[model samples]
Target chain A: MMKIDVSLSKRLGDFDWQARFSAEGGQLGVFGPSGSGKSTLMNLLAGLLKPDSGHIRLDGSPIFESASSINLPPEKRRIGVVFQHAHLFPHMGVRRNLLYGFRRTPANERRIDTNDLIEALNLGPLLDRGVKRLSGGERQRVALGRTLLACPRLILMDEPLTGLDEGLKYQIIPYLKQVFNRFEIPYIFISHSLNEMRLMTDRVLEFAQGEMTGEVSSELLARRGMGTGQGGYSNLMEMGRLREDDGLYIYRWGGQEICLSNGGDQDTGMFEIMSKDITLFKRHPEASSARNMLQCRVVKVFEAGNRIGVELDCHGQRLMSQVVGSAVRDLGLEPGSAIIAVIKASAFRRLY
Target chain B: MFEFSPTDWQAISLSAQVAITATAVSLPFGFMAAYLLVFSRLPGKALLDSLINLPLVLPPVVVGYLLLLSLGSEGWLGAMLAKVGIRIIFTWKAAVIASMVVGFPLLVRSIRIGMEQIDDHLIQASRTLGAHWHDTLLSVILPLSGRAILAGASLMFARSLGEFGATIILAGNIPGVTQTIPLAIYDYTSTPGGDRMALGLCLVSIVLSFGVLVLNEGLVRRFRKGVK
Candidate 1:
């Protein structure tokens, strides 16, 4: 039920910014390419940067307005921001960094307990360790924990995972997901990575050339990436119980079993399969080299660039695949068509 | 080995007193000034930056003369102080003032460099995390720039120890009084057949400056260890 309404404009040299939008905030997203005024939106919302002229409201309260000259300072705004790079105070230990904002908040106003957040962030062991000694993933975790401990009404994360490596990025997403689900804190997740946006956000506001081009659901945003030459859409799956078999990890997803070449001994894991990596066959090929093959019903076929994006239901789980236009015609693919999909064991990339 | 006279010992001790006092007194102002220069988007910032650096570029004698003109009995500040029953000129306090004015730019410069290096996002993060400006300054900016503050203080202290033209002009070369080691050396050189005494004071000056630098280094190493 959290709500945010912003209508602001700013001119930075040649790049002019004009955006007007309102969102019912629950895992809201600001999605765009680089230099698309995404960071501008974040700074404006957080009150880190002033707008040329506009008004911003959160939960029916005007945090900033040009007409009446009511621009709340950042602290008074209570909108926490996680910058691109985790900016933990270098002089403080991990424990102090987490408690910094909590201590600043009034006792009556403070909602989240410090110990609960530390436990959620798994920071017990690192409490006394200085920030300089932490790794990239741990530093980002601390930054997130610190912001959360402040009990912000709305959190603005500007590409928080962009600074970490691919391996570390996936590892941290689970923690982020767990914290958000447990606390249910409204947040506007900002990122250019379509996969990340699809994973972390529910609704996305797309930005291009310093303007909000469109606002769409997170799923449609990922689908839009198909024709942009950034590769086809990615279908992410949250798999249940995990087990290792013959050096391959078998994971349960949508009443289907998936084999992955790489996975750890976690109770549950998330994995992503790109559309391009899935191959559709009319009939089950005998003696196929691919590790896994499943007969799926084609849910839908849509045109994407010169290719066709196929949405398939494999054992009630939705999976996306892409094929050339000629292939779709050759196979006579359409909704309700039973097609066999072959995937390599290495195609499933473990997210956590 | 040089023979130490009681007057020579007094000069050494007095020099220490003046340098330590000047650095200690300037530390807070230097920190504030550096913070303003680094963080504030003031319109007159360029002018303010140049003004702080004026003494650094100007000759010590020129700075001393300016201090004299402004601090003398007939001057505006001097008259204002006179009404309050305060006298600054020709006292050890004047020596401390002279050292402070000469060494202030170095202190501010070192601190400014450190403050500038602190990531702006860190300040923004603290603010967005519900910290007021004062809270951020104390919890984030202050500790982050502590090493630079220490560096600036030590550098200013070393500079103050060598202060000569300004101190002599303002405090005068009165032995066992406002006269420091440098002034004592000046007195020895001007006196007949006092070359050995002048050289002795010069050695003491080198030792004092070296000791300050060594102490600064040791403290910095300990700070680094604590951080890690």
Candidate 2:
């Protein structure tokens, strides 16, 4: 299992950001508010920036140790990063950008095959094209290919999807998933959106004011959101087979199907539905405008401040709904209660 | 109609050689100075920055006077070179040196602007891709700054071609030897009934400057196309 331990501090403008984190194993999702030291942590991990005072270690190697005055440069640390802007060398073609790190890797140490990555990332047509000619989605894919070719022990992605719209984000998510599934190396994915982080990884590190508040499984965070009512919950369902129905697109997941207003013939991917957008009714509302109504059994009902948090099991897939305490009592919602969860087809936001 | 004298031809050829030599020799140093000023965290950086730009702010004759004091036959650098049996004063080499010193700041200023305009993230990306500083400099910074370097070299070359104050003071206007186009033009203008010769050389200077500007633009556009 790969491991990381970092404790660093720096002053930014008027605030002191004390960044600290420790992680082990699977891809870690770093979720935080703006100016919460997420990017600082990434830079520190990648050796782009040194900490004021602390040590950073990866898999037992000392990348940075302030007390010992040991600081390995970014190149020496074998870390790869995909910045928010992609930062592809504008002077280089796609092929050169991808091969830049490949050439730098020692022959015996190189694990990635250039042809395989090019094929996997579908970079064949783009190899000879200049970086400026690529679309945003294509640029991200090329950036991913470039970073992967480096054969880094750790990778850090800083808000890779922040600027992308919903459609473009879905287009890029599979490539990201392919990296984690195919490569054994550990990586930290940073983003401010929980929806984006949820689709990327289960283990998330939430930051606030330059410190990590907690590291929890995505499910637990959603559950916490359900309990608090302040932190709204969302469910990510891994979409399976796909088909077209009239002008709408139908997606199969967990023995049930969800319909989308559009996106027919698109590749299968994951999508998120906000828990607040889902309403629980004791019986099907025959006159509702919501396009999706799944018959589900109430898994649990818990107190959420002045609200009621309902966890439901629909065709073996978990979904959440929040209702006021008065409504919960009026609907007689409780554990093992049967209900129809209503959601709009427009609410099915694809998670690329 | 535009027949030139042997002296005029010799001065034209000497000026071209001196400008090319000055630009060529100073290119690497100017690049390094610009890179350091833009990227390095050296102590007294402000002072270093000011010192690199001193030539642009100071008068050319003043620069030549200082060069004479520091590099004259009896001066410290000249004494050291003299110990090695090398003399630079009142030579064509001195003309090249004078041109280089006067034009150094222009080269540095243009290159520094280019370096400053580069996105730092590109450098960071290269580092994370396992390229060391030298590799990054060669593979990224230099290529991205190609246009600006060309602009700077063109400016320096043009400046060197027209260099008169320093070249006359240090190298002297010796015909067919230390004399360049500008020096020879000065000589022709000062002599009685030499207006035609002076005007011919003046036309040559304008044409040379114009040609350099056109060539620089073409080269910069080609480099940018290759880059994109």
User: Which candidate has the highest lDDT of all?
Assistant: 1
* Tens digit per residue, CA lDDT, model 1, B83-189: 99999999999999999999999999988977887888889988988888988899889988888889889999999999999999989989888989999999999
True contacts reproduced, candidate 1: 0.93
Total backbone collisions for each predicted model: 0, 2
Per-residue lDDT tens digits for candidate 2, residues A172-288, read 877787766776667889998766777778899888887777788876766766655454577777786478788777888778888877553556666777777888788878788
- By summed lDDT, the worst window of 10 consecutive residues in model 1 chain B runs over B219-228
Q: Candidate 1: list runs displaced more than 4 Å.
A: A229-231, A242-248, B214-228
* Top candidate when judged by DockQ against the true structure: 2
lDDT computed for candidate 2: 0.85
Provide chain B TM-scores across all predictions: 0.95, 0.95
For model 2, what is the error of residue A76's alpha carbon versus the real structure, in angstroms, after optimal superposition? 0.3
